[model samples]
Target chain A: MTAVPDAIDQALGIAPGSPLHALRALRPEFVSGAEACRAAVLDPEETLDLSPELRRAIARRVVAGAGHDRLTEGYPRPADPALAALADGEMPEDFALAALARHADLIAETPAKAGPEHLSALQEAGFSVPQIIALSELLAFACYQIRVVHGLGLLKETRA
Target chain B: MTDTIPQVTLKPLTWTPHLPPVEIEDATPRQLEAMKVTPSAKKVSPYVRTLAHDPDSYVARTVLFNAIMYAEGGLNRADRELGALGASLINGCKYCANVHARQHARLTGTATTSALYAGRRDALNPRDAAIMDFAEALTATPPTAEQSHVEALRAQGMEDAEIQDLIHSIAIFGWANRLMHPLGHSD
Candidate 1:
């Protein structure tokens, strides 16, 4: 079956049937999800009103993505001594993967405790759900970019 | 004047399985009371209470809650519990991990708390596994998340709005993971 277009593709001008399409097609749920997301972004009240099932599905996706990424990026590789040490239950300087995952889950589910002003600011800034997702992607990319630059010695030198 | 030789001593850092737990005695009675009375019934340790009490300054909490409640499309109790497990696993906060894992085990009657604490994927339900993967990506790597990454979840029958909310959930968790790493008490 042909995969549905992703909201990112629709928002960012990526064409359907391109690599993005193929990638999104990898997950059947994601294909239909992209369609639903497109509708929600297009019309929040009418199309994307929150439902219990939708919420659960969303939570599942977010947690899965984050968990996969943490395993790949945050931890030491299998060949590394650090990895072995960690697996053996040694305390690393940083937080463990499990703790991070839990924290991420909690943060994602917390309600909008911000005052009227911040909420208004976000709304005024055209912060729809898709836009928020885009921002998140942007932030992640920014962190990655900073790490790349720092690794390359492009960042300013600081005293240790 | 004769030059004196400088002496340098290297102290080897020892790795410990557990951190010295944060002491309640360090907190004031009011703070202790707040910790005791917080809604979760999970004692908000003094450190978490310190952060929660200053609700105005804890921007992360507000943003995270909104993302979970509104952007993530409003997770149910089970979903929230699962999300909590996923985040705790990724962050490796022993205290939080132990607490949430126990809760998850109690609720789901599946994986043991130890397995969850170890980040053992095999022990989790398939849906929970998928959610865990999503949470890790959102927390650890955003830009590298290929279109396929999202598609995988969709292939599993997730809807579009749900996917968007999922992203929000990850974003919120990502923010929280960082905050808790340095500021939260786990000992």
Candidate 2:
């Protein structure tokens, strides 16, 4: 059997040749592109002034907040105690990390509720424009991954 | 330019970025490639340019988005567009909502779009209602989509592949809305 080559499949435990796996195969680009996107957002070539550890921690926080405990496993807490605390949803004492956590939660929970003031807050906390964009991408990816996982879980349960 | 999320509309809308967009002239070769700005290409949208600040993510996102929304042979474009509209509406990303609403209208008709904008799912046909219902549920935070949602789509005659298509189309907007809504506002 072909190994489950996609992250979504691995996350969901989709066996090769399973019906859901076949369904995913119908659109190979989405599977591959999603992997690429995962890499770009989670472990990008450029950190955009946001450290890789902070990004992973933020992703864990957002995914955990989305209530995907299983998905949270994919993003282990960072070694640094502060980063680990951030991943656990504790508000960091650092103003910048705290600000980033709040922004991540807002975007993950209620994207529509976000506004210009949110970006301004990031700026005030010392995030540059590129850093803000990179942060947004990470938050966006977490939100997207949660939905995909949830949607696929439904498919597996009902259609399996 | 409006800083607030607008009500869903069919009218053409513009996106205003909260952060400064990458200056196209000063763009690195990677950023330019990610934006797909060839010599003959028309002007890129501010959204694209702004996103290009992180070229790797931008390129990967674009590739995934195009495959989910524009690829052939699973769900039809009109249905995928409706799925996009449903997620956008729920997320209150007026910019994404407006774009997909227009696409949904063009490929199908304005009836479904009108119904969705008016918050009247009952007015939609059973198939569209099922699709929209699933879209909203899946797009919700912590996602309320259940087995019933899959069953509903199956009952509407959507194959597993088509339902998969619908899922991706709706889910991508969750990503899109977060980026678009928070990073910028629509006018």
Cα displacement (angstroms), candidate 2, residue A83, comes to: 0.8
Task: Give the alpha carbon lDDT tens digit for every residue of A33-105 in model 2.
Answer: 8899999998889877677888889989988866666788888889998898889999998898889888888
CA shift of A43, model 1, Å: 31
Model 1 stretches astray by more than 4 angstroms: A1-160, B1-45, B52-55, B63-76, B112-115, B141-143
RMSD of each: 20.4, 4.6
* Model 1, span A1-160: residue lDDT tens: 3443343344233355454344334434434433343233222332223332322222333333333332223222334443333333343343432332232233333312212343234335444432323222222222322222111121011111
Off by over 4 Å in 2: A1-4, A157-160, B1-9
- Each candidate's interface RMSD (Å, one decimal) is 16.0, 1.5
lDDT of candidate model 2 versus the reference = 0.86
Residue-by-residue lDDT tens digits, candidate 1, B1-187:
1322232222222222111222455544543453454445655444344343322223223433443534323344444455555654565434444554555556665443444445455765566666666655544433234445555655676554445445544444444443443333344
For candidate 2, write residues B2-80 as lDDT tens digits. Answer: 2222234478998999888998899999999888889898498899999999998998998899999999788999999
lDDT of each: 0.38, 0.86
- Report the Cα lDDT for residue B20, model 1: 27
* Interface RMSD (Å) of candidate 2: 1.5
